[model samples]
Target: MSLREAVAALVSDGDLVAIEGFGHLVPVAAAHEIIRQGRSDLTLARMSCDVTVDQLIAAGCVSTLISSFVGNSSAGSLHELRRRVEHDDPAPLRLEEYSHGGMVARYTAGASRLPFAAINSYRGSDLPTLNPEIRTVTDPYGSGDIYVVPALRPDVSIIHAQRADEHGNVQAWGILGIQTEAAFAADRVIVTVEEIVDDDVIRSDPNRTIIPAHAVTAVVECPWGAFPHAVQGYYDRDDAFARRWSELARNPHEMHVWLDANIRGTSDFDAHLELVGHPRDGRLNVTEAFPSPVNYGGRR
Candidate 1:
């Protein structure tokens, strides 16, 4: 399926959607597609909540954000997010903050179909005071006080992978960062990849299969799906573009112009690629050249 189609089909209004990536393979294209489709009143979940989350908030596509931290790579805080929460610019953003470990526990619990997850975090922090979602639970083994967070089962989970088969078997490497858990926890999963390969290629390296075909609802072959963010083994992070976004997207008017020119203006992902410059231009090539061979059959 196409990126636009996948976003339209999988993501819906008021859905709890999670587009997650740690440092690499961020699903920026899908987020843009959501904005282009004019989906609003969404509750977005992510770990770091990088550029995509910021843009979604600026576009008024989001009403709530669930995450540990939200920041640009080197551009400091996401000014748009700050403005929404701080000044209530476009709309007031309802926040559900959690510690890094607490979020992981929540996703883990959801993936495992558990009601809640207990962790020994936020003991001395003000998260429990600030966020009511953070609750205390008694240890079953009588170990005294414990902090627990509810499972985060998103309505849809969109993730960008390095490669995938037409059957939706996703293969990703480098900085996965809770993608598997988020996919497993979601009711529907949409995977946008750099390329869709033969089933044999995916089967050859089964270990790289992060999200199996059964968990995926849609498979989109979107080249440069993680534009402006690094896709390990495929391309380097577009730091210049990231910085430019940080500078220009602070103002609401500038954000509108940026979205109109780059997102709404482009007909499809191919047009987006052309506007952003070709991936083969070498500007976004990987800094390191470590080519690890895929060992299919090994005698241990």
Candidate 2:
């Protein structure tokens, strides 16, 4: 399915959507598509919220954020996020703040099909004071108090990968975030890849298969899905564009104009890719410098 189709079919208003990526491979394209489709009152979940979340917030596509940290990766503060939280310019963004571990624990519990996961992340902090859900769980073995958080089962999760087969078997390299857990925890998973390869190629190196095909609901071949943010071995992060977006996001008129030209104005993902000036001439290709290919076929 196309990126637009995948999001339209899987996501709806008032849905909890998780777009997982650590540093790179953030599903900005999927988020843009959601905005273009005019989704509203969405609760977005991310371990580390960055420009993508900021864009959605500016576009009025998100009303709540389930986040550990909300800011730009390199830049200090995401303009729109700050504007909404501080000024409530567009709308008041209801935030569910958590530690990085708290966010991860939520997904882990959901992936494991458990009610909640306990961690010692928010014990000493003031997070519990602000958010009442952060509670203490007594250890059954008579240990000390530990904090527990409810599982985050998102209505839909969109994950971008280096590559995937048509069947939706995703394989990604570089910094691995909690994407595997996020995909498993969501009710529906959309795996958007730079390219869709043959199953034979995907299975040749099984170690790269993070999310299997069975867990995926939709597969979209969206090249440059993670533009502006790097995709591991693919392109380098577009710092110029990121800086421009940060500046434009500070003003509502400028931000909307940028979104209209780049996101809403574009007809499709490919068109947006073209609009952003992403080159397909092997400029973002990855090279395997390491020559070793080990096989622990039968160590036991």
Best by the TM-score measure: 1
Q: For residues 1-300, what per-residue lDDT tens digits would candidate 1 score against the true structure?
A: 887778878888999998898899998889989988999999999989888898888778999999998888786678899888898987799999998898899999999999999988688999999998889988889999899999999999989999999999999988779999999999999989999999999988899999999999999998888888889888888777778778877777987887788778888766777876766688777776676785567788
TM-score (C-alpha) between model 1 and the true structure: 0.95
Whose lDDT is greatest here? 1
Considering only N, C-alpha and C atoms within 3 Å, which residue pairs clash in candidate 2? none
Per-model TM values vs. the true structure: 0.95, 0.94
- Candidate 1 clashing pairs, residues 3+ apart or interchain: none
Local distance difference test, each candidate: 0.88, 0.87
Over the stretch 56-135, how does candidate 2's per-residue lDDT look in tens digits? 88788999999998777766679888888888876788989998989999999999999999988676799999888788
